[model samples]
Target: MQTITWQQFEQTDIRVGTIIEVTDFPEARKPAYKLMIDLGPLGIRKSSAQITSLYTKEELVGKQVLCVTNLGNKQIGKYISEVLVTGFEDGHQNIVLAQPASPVPNGSKLM
Candidate 1:
């Protein structure tokens, strides 16, 4: 594995955000959802998550999730993703969201 210095790791701003809205993204080549997330003091942000196989819109709403907030925007067709919703690929390659064991304040930085 490649080792990164503590400074390098700290430079990545991973924070918590709660999903506030969910919409279908038919324009994406892969099945995905357009999400509006509330990052507390950071305000609302948008993201595109391909976790449709394991999650539903109803389940995602109000769910606090980990996000990489400083990667900059990614353009997917016409949608601009402001943050990267973090997750891990399952054995089937389906994404399982990275989240806290219990609810934490939105925009809480990962330590």
Candidate 2:
């Protein structure tokens, strides 16, 4: 794997956001969800996460998750993903969302 300097890593705008909406994305080749997150000062941003194996739509609402905000927008079929929902892969290859240990203000930057 390639290594990056700490300064370069800091350039990544990882922040906290609350999931306000979740919907199924059938258009995606892989199973995923369409999410609308409230990023406080950043406003609402949309994301597409392939976390269906470990998460349900009903359970995701109101959950605080880590987001990479400055990745720019990505087009997934007709859906426009505005932010990246950060996560790691589980042993079974399911996505495990990266989240704060405690509740933090939405849009709070990672330090």
The candidate that achieves the highest TM-score relative to the unseen native structure: 1
Model 2 lDDT per residue over 84-111, tens place: 9999988899999999999999999999
Q: Where does model 1 exceed 4 Å of error?
A: none
lDDT of 1 by residue, 46-103 (tens): 9999999999999999999999999999999999999999999999989999999999
TM-score of each: 0.98, 0.96
RMSD of each: 0.6, 0.8
- Measured with C-alpha atoms, the lDDT of residue 53 in candidate 2 is 94
In angstroms, give how far residue 11 of model 1 lies from its true place.
Answer: 0.3
